[model samples]
Target: MKLPNTAHTSRPWRIHEIAHDFLLEDVWALPTPGGPDDFPRLVRQMTSGSNTNDSRAYTALFEIRWRLGKLFGWDRPDAGIVARVPSLRDRLPADLLAGPRGPVFSSVPFTSVYQTDDEWVAEMANRTVHALMHMSWVADEGGGYHGQMAVLVKPNGWFGRGYMAAIKPIRYLVVYPALLRMIGRTWELQAAG
Candidate 1:
């Protein structure tokens, strides 16, 4: 479910340190409720792209976005991390840096940054924005843990800001809801198996 921005900002996440300059674009409470040990399972499912592929709308949107990006040089090498903006990994604390870097996504564009017992962070960058996807295992009030995902972004400039604004409705209305349903169904199947 979509959550208030404060749901992320109010938390004492380590991501806040490195992403202070970025805006909190979205916060969501994932439907994958389970035990603490299930975080790795959740992260694995996400990185594996098991949930996002089922939606035709998502596929179409992504295809169009990618084509547009290619045609406009919006994802060109010169506009990515270390070219346009430094990587968030560069700001990782020594302890986080020493731990296992998170899993590399199989079907997504993001690169893993860090992983811990309760949290994982990944990053993606393009001409439009430098973005971070953070996932955390949080204990629910009803007892048991569920996943929380947050998106943070630093838009490139006016164009980036406009791009984000233009996509906000589509993201909230179609992409995220579809993804949530997929994740929930996938999690149910995994748990059942």
Candidate 2:
């Protein structure tokens, strides 16, 4: 991985820097496989539109894998979707649930820590798994930091705003309300305990 000169002064936003800073030394020991074969297909299904299974899988492979490339110190984020480690399911930080919403945080640095093209993809897959399983069971949608660049499918002038409006109902009504319920349950469970 190429170290950024800027990284010397402050945290760099480049994917390589993010990976090196956050994921270094930790990723190699992760349980994920070395390449594409290890990625989770279930994640693709949750995020993709009505594209063919292969196409959806392929797209997930490319985007998530690209993100993973930075984690390993590769120059380009790369392309292609791939599997992640099962250990990714190990646990989310309890702090991830502490935010006002549901712990949806992101940063350029987070993308870089994936260690390989597939690791990023796997992390995304893990996010989707959380979204699917707990989309309605938490307070914030990962603390309202639902990841970045994932929503910019066609970020044209009006396209972005229009897309936001189209999904506004779902975002505010369905997802948010469901998230409240999820968070409520957690509190309730803790209270019961």
Candidate 3:
């Protein structure tokens, strides 16, 4: 299934810009703060829960990237950043490639390359956006915004039910805009302070 079109006209949360920014930051982040060893470490850190074949690794990595991006300053939730990590995963070394069925999972690596890139800024914005999008799950139902909590470990289903379930407030009216504003302001605050 294809994701919603994000071209011209009215945008979805202005997510297209966010996506572009995320990719730019990601390209740079990959080389500077996280190179060969660090990238592999990040991969291991995020893919710890599953057998590598499960798409859960992708989701988990997105979550970790979001947290790191926020801490660093990139917080836009861009589509490019979402696409980049997986691109990186697609290009992993032979030894690093592991899956439940071995060959079945080898085709997808380096998906993270879809992020935004600013040769000058080194994709910092893209990385931040990537991280924020992943963290949507935590911000949506972590008791601060919503009264009730869900205990869903695996957020994958036939029709994106799991994805929709996980991204409650981010997809809704309340939490997403707040996060966007807060993180965007944080970038300014960091610059000013």
Candidate with maximal TM-score: 1
Candidate 3, residue 97: Cα displacement in angstroms equals 14
- Find the 10 residues in a row with the least total lDDT in model 1: 49-58
Report the lDDT tens digits of candidate 1 across residue range 1-193. 9899998888888888877898889999999999878999999999987773578898799899999999999998898888888888899999999998888889877889999898899998998999999999999998899999999998989999999999999998889988899999999988988
| Model 2 CA deviation exceeding 4 Å by range | 1-157
Better of 2 and 3 by TM-score: 3
- Cα deviation of 107, candidate 3, in Å: 29
Candidate 3 lDDT over 97-161, as tens digits, reads 34221111122221222211110001212431223222101112223211111111211233234
lDDT of 2 by residue, 64-173 (tens): 64575466433332221133322222333343223222122232112211222122322332211211121111112233211111111112236334644565565444
Better of 1 and 2 by lDDT: 1
Give Cα distance to truth, residue 74, candidate 1, Å: 0.9
lDDT of 1 at 68: 98
For model 3, the stretches where C-alpha displacement exceeds 4 angstroms are 1-88, 91-116, 119-155, 163-170
Give lDDT per model, in order: 0.90, 0.28, 0.28
